[model samples]
Target: MTATTTPNSHTATGERADLLTALAKQRHFLRFTTRDLTDEQAGLRTTASALCLGGLVKHVTSVERIWADFIVDGPSAMPDFTAWTEADLARRADEFRMLPGETLAGVLAEYAEVARRTDDLVTALPDLGATQPLPKAPWFEADAEWSARRVLMHVVAETAQHAGHADIIRESLDGAKSMG
Candidate 1:
């Protein structure tokens, strides 16, 4: 189903629009902090942690893929996490390190791709109340009884949470500041 914008949606600009604002804000924060860093600086962990800008991109991409595919697009295999276990321990152990060959551009682009696809699903599905089984949130009253509306809200919520995470990582990259 297609999403129709309403005349009374000036405040939030519709549900999807409101959510997109959060996504864009988060994306913007991530982009600016790592804007001109070389591949080296992109993954550099200044503090005693592994929470670098590049890794944050990777982390956000993983998150969008999960919510968009599982929560918004029904069931599907998450491609990003296929080999994650191998790098999982390393990333988890440290809060600010970049993996080999990891680039800010590449990871951000992938995240953008996932965000677009998620937007498509949200706009196409008319019934927010039409629920699907989200593997991550397995206890959500079962898949058959799930509502599209709830899933949409959940996606935004999840994105917002990660956006906070990204914000912290962004500040750590440099003395950069963000407001939104």
Candidate 2:
């Protein structure tokens, strides 16, 4: 699709259309960071941080999926963070590292699918004004609420932030840059 093409170009327009466009642009950059790298290269921790290209893909996929679910089903739909066991928490913390058998190709495909679903949700939701209480997470303020639009913006921010992280990781891996 052209840069002018909004998210869900078949139907989206106005602010929602613009938001979709921004989100897509972030996703594009994130994918660009992973291009032309082998599985081994993609999994290399080029920096002191544990982050790798494949892990970033997995992370962004998880973030978008969770927020998209919130946009559709509200706070209760989110995973019960308080209920997570130590092992579950450890696994969640390790999402930014490539696990055995997790190929770059597979992770990228999953990320793309999540992006598509998020775009579809943006197009299908009748009300961007729909609000959901924020879950009781340490990062979130107490009793906070977010509209669907806010959730979309959050996804955009999350994707964009991680894309920058991925760009640095990719550059460190082989001196490749996602931008000119």
Candidate 3:
């Protein structure tokens, strides 16, 4: 699928460095995806499911935190949205929507913070060939095993998918051009 690319694309290394390509591509995807949301639009839930830009972002963030913990650190427990209903979803929605006491500025500010954090993790753990046991997870001890490489792919996939969602949601909110 052709995606909306960011204007200031991050640097890519090597001719066939799959990891580099995924990281750069996903980073740009994120930048362009969240380019158009207003404080209100970020929080708006206008459809039947009423998915809002903010809700998606928050979901992505939480998901990233959880996965990063697993990859860079170890599997960390976080909220499971699958077990949630509208009210639970709405509460997450509010995280994106800048309430009277909220600020969209902070959410936007996170663009760089997240980038830096993920970049550090990628740079530090450039090798993905090793497999580690998830000690806390009993099920992982059996048939469930993943390599560092697979974990990296998972992060790229997760970010890239959400970035796509952000692109569409942002476009619906405003006619602003994504830096593609």
Q: For each candidate, how many residue pairs have backbone atoms clashing (under 3 Å)?
A: 16, 0, 1
lDDT tens readout by residue for model 2, 4-107:
44334556768767888899889999999989988898889999998898999899999999999988778878877767799988988778878888898999
When summed lDDT is taken over every stretch of 10 residues in candidate 2, the lowest stretch is 1-10
Compared with the true structure, what per-residue lDDT tens digits does model 1 show for residues 1-180?
A: 123332233223466666556555556666666666788777776656556667766776676676666654565543333345757766554434466666667776777787667666665566556656544333443444446666556655655665566556656777665564
Q: Clashes in model 3: which pairs?
A: 70-74
Q: Evaluate model 1: give its TM-score.
A: 0.67
In model 2, residue pairs whose N, Cα or C atoms come closer than 3 Å (at least 3 residues apart or on different chains), thus clashing, are: none
Of the two candidates 1 and 2, the one with more favorable TM-score, higher being better, is: 2
- On the 0 to 100 scale, the lDDT of residue 173 in model 1 is 70
TM-score of each: 0.67, 0.93, 0.66
Supply candidate 2's per-residue lDDT for 163: 95
Candidate 2 stretches with Cα past 4 Å from truth are: 1-9
Better model by TM-score, 2 or 3? 2
lDDT against the true structure, each candidate: 0.60, 0.87, 0.59
Residue 152 in model 2: lDDT: 94
Q: What C-alpha RMSD separates each model from the true structure?
A: 6.0, 2.2, 6.1
- Error (Å) of candidate 2 at residue 41 is 0.8
